[model samples]
Every structure is written in C-alpha cells, then in structure tokens.
Target: MLTATLCALLLVNLWTILRFREDKRRAVAGARRIPEADLLALALIGGTPGAFFARHRFRHKTRKQPFSTWLWLIAAIQAGALIGFGWPR
Candidate 1:
C-alpha cells in the first residue's frame, strides 16, 4: 500500500511539473494558459514539492501575487499535518 501510494505521488508530481512547464511555455508564447486554480489544486494535493521544484527550475510564478502566498500556505499546512499525524509506518 505504501509503495502504491508513493508511486501515485510520484506520478502526480511529474504531472504537476509538466503542467507548470506547459504554463510557462504558454506564457512565453502568449497563448492560452493553465488556470492558477488548477495549479493550486495540484499543490493542495501532494504536488507541493513538485510545484516548488518547477517554480524554481522554470522561474515561473516566483513573484506572482496571492499565488505565491497561497503556495506557501499550502506547503505550511502540509508540513503541519505531517508533523501532527506522524509518518506512515
């Protein structure tokens, strides 16, 4: 079960990274872009790490208002939950 869960998380993170990359590409091309809510939703799940990774790697949304705040909030909440609940054995 743990292995399966980890695998699923890995895939989600990868998808999240791809989404960020696509969004960046669209931004540069002045094309339709992925909604911010969708990106936040991804982070709200287990994609926080990937979100940050992609943000730094692609330099995307680094200074976006409210979005940066929301991302940090999500990361903080996730960290708190992990600390409170303890790790899965």
Candidate 2:
C-alpha cells in the first residue's frame, strides 16, 4: 500500500509539473498572466512542489507583489500542515 501510494503521488507530481508548464506557456502568450487564487488552489490540491519549481523554472510568480507573496504563504501553510499533521497515527 505504501508503494502504491508513493507511485500515485509520483504520478500526481508529474501531472502537476506538466500542468504548470502549460499554464506558464499560456500566461506568457496571453500577456495577462494567471491569477494567484488559481495557483493557490492547485498548490493546496497537492501541487505545491510543482508550483515552487514552476516559479523558479519559468521565472514566474516571483514578483514581490501580493500574488507571489500569497502563493508562497500558501505553500508555507501547506508545508506546515504536512509536517505537523501528516505523520502516521
């Protein structure tokens, strides 16, 4: 079960990465940019790792504006939740 769950997480991580790439491309092309709320939702839905990588890889959401800060904040919260509550019972 652990192995299966690891595999599933790996697949989800990869999918999130691909989605981030696509979303970044669209943001670059549309010239309007994606919103932070959407990004936060993705991160909350197990996409935080991908979002962090995307911010660095694509140089996206790296600004000091509220959007970037908020996303980072969300990422931090997610990390806290994982570390604080994800242990086995």
Candidate 3:
C-alpha cells in the first residue's frame, strides 16, 4: 500500500510538471492558458514539490501575485501535516 501511494504521488508530480510546461508554452504563444486554480489544485494534492521545481525550471508564474501566495500556503499546510502526522508506516 505504501509503495502504491508513493507511485501515485510520483505520477501526480510528473503530471504537474507537464502541466506547468504546457502552460509556459501557451503563455509564450499567447494562447489559452491553464487556469491558476487547476495548477493550485495539483499542488494541493501532494504536487507541491513538483510545482516549485517547475516554477524554477520553467520560470513560470514565479512572480504572479495571488498564485505565488497560494502555492506557498499550500506547501506550508502540507509541511505542517507531514510534521504533525509523521511518515507513513
């Protein structure tokens, strides 16, 4: 069960990175973009690491106002939860 959960998280993070890449591509092309809510939702669900990585790698949404604030908040909450509960057995 633990292995399965870890695998799922890996997949989700990969997906989040892909989404960030796609969003960056669209931004450069001036095309329709991925919604901030969707990106934040991905980070909220154990993709915070991926989100931060993609933000640095793609230089996407780094300085965005509320988005950056919200992403940091999500990371803080996730960190708090991990600290409170400890690692899975």
Compared with the true structure, all predictions reach lDDT values of 0.96, 0.73, 0.96
In model 2, the number of clashes is 0
Model 3, 1-89: lDDT tens digits are: 98999999999999999999999999999999999999999999989999999999999999999999999999999988988898543
Clashing pairs in 3: none
Higher-ranked by lDDT: 1 or 2: 1
What candidate 2 gets wrong by more than 4 Å, as runs, is 31-35, 86-89
Q: What TM-score would each prediction reach against the true structure?
A: 0.96, 0.69, 0.96
Write candidate 1's Cα lDDT for 15-48 as tens digits.
9999999999999999999999999999999999
Candidate 1 — worst ten consecutive residues by lDDT sum?
80-89
lDDT tens digits, residue span 15-75, model 2:
6667667777887788665555766777777777877787788776678488677777877
Judge candidate 3 against the unseen true structure and give its global Cα lDDT, from 0 to 1.
Answer: 0.96
